[model samples]
Target: MLQETSRDPVGVLVVEDDAVTRKALCLAIESDPGLKLLDAFDSVKPALDFLESSSPDVLMTDLGLPDGSGIDIIHACARRHPATDIMVVTMSSDEANVLACIEAGASGYVLKDAGKLDIARAVLDLRAGGAPMSPAIARMVLAKVRDNKKPAVPQSSPASDTTSLTRREAAILDLIAQGESYGEVAKMLSVSVGTVQTHIKNIYGKLSVHSRGEAVYEAHRRGLLQLGRPPGKRS
Candidate 1:
């Protein structure tokens, strides 16, 4: 894990094919005082070559590239720099590509149309071990989970619920299922973002979910989505 000191910003590596999109992503990440542009590449080979020597705290890549698929870069990061937070910023929302990225250890997925701020925010949230998937991407992932029929825990196992989470954990899981960001959840719960992250880590472990989308799906499968509702049920 890269340590964050007052002297260093969060290092970011961007890999996108489109020149305009690449420039936009670079500017968005660098514009933030919290993030430093480590490097930006338009192809997978160079990015992978660069990763051979260095590992940024965050690796953001698109799905398609001239030389090859961006999933290769994601796989390299997962193997070479396991601590790095990998996010997919691409136009492809196809189920196969999304599932491939997830299996390759991507932490988040944002569409190309998400705007610069959303991209930057997704990178930061991912670095903090919070899955920052866009709403549409989240939905796609949930669809796959349903199609697979692989529940987080077996339906016949009642003890799974009893030993799975504490009330606070359940509450945190609920908020996450509702698509609340870590920062938003922190403010709502009167806790620090780090605390929220810690809870998220625990949530991921208990639920066996790698991304926010999967966590939400698992929560629903386990009948915990209703618990995530806020007071006075607006619906």
Candidate 2:
């Protein structure tokens, strides 16, 4: 159990299309004394509108909303309140949707099958600056990063000239290509996770890649990583 914050209970907003699920989520929020249900909506528009005027401590939503994808909601919350903890509570466990949500700035990913206690715990964990991802979602994320393939060489390529990486940047990319998560890389490098994330952002800019797998492929193409066996596999 977490100590009550000096502030009001953590405000949580829910956006789910299914009436029953939405009601259940509301109940979960209501049951937890540490969390307060700020608002609940069944579509994207109303949710977006409410977000524009108010921001919650946590935003949990299902991806396949009736009006639009929850990625839009994630983007909106991320843009409006950078400190807000955004989570995806959806049925889709595919790599594509998981990656999409991550790219959209979601820090927590929970499957809808999770119990109410689990959902409450996820909300509290997110409030504590933890990334609460289900075990299946965690496996999917790891698989996505570990499944990098060599990108095809283009006819007129400029990314090949990506030799501007600093020594530390290259080192960070190497660790990431080795299937190390940001937290793992941070621990290995004796740096904070935010420091690692900053370096990763710089790496992406230098490599012209958007995600971890793309960064790995680009690093390999640029000879930053030793051409070798599968990533995350120890020799």
Candidate 2 lDDT over 158-216, as tens digits, reads: 65653567767777777765556666666777677778778877876676554454466
* Model 1 TM-score, all chains together: 0.66
Give lDDT tens digits, candidate 1, residues 1-235: 1222235678999999899989988999878888999999999899999999998888899988999999999888877876677888889888889878877778688887755446667777776547777788888876765575543454677535553666667777777655566676677777777777787778767766555555665666776555425723422
Tell me how many clashing residue pairs each candidate has. Answer: 0, 0
For each candidate, give its TM-score against the true structure: 0.66, 0.65
Clashing pairs in 2: none
- Per-candidate RMSD vs. true structure? 5.6, 6.1
Looking at model 1, the pairs that clash are none
Error of 1 at 165 (Å): 11
Candidate closest to the true structure, highest TM-score? 1
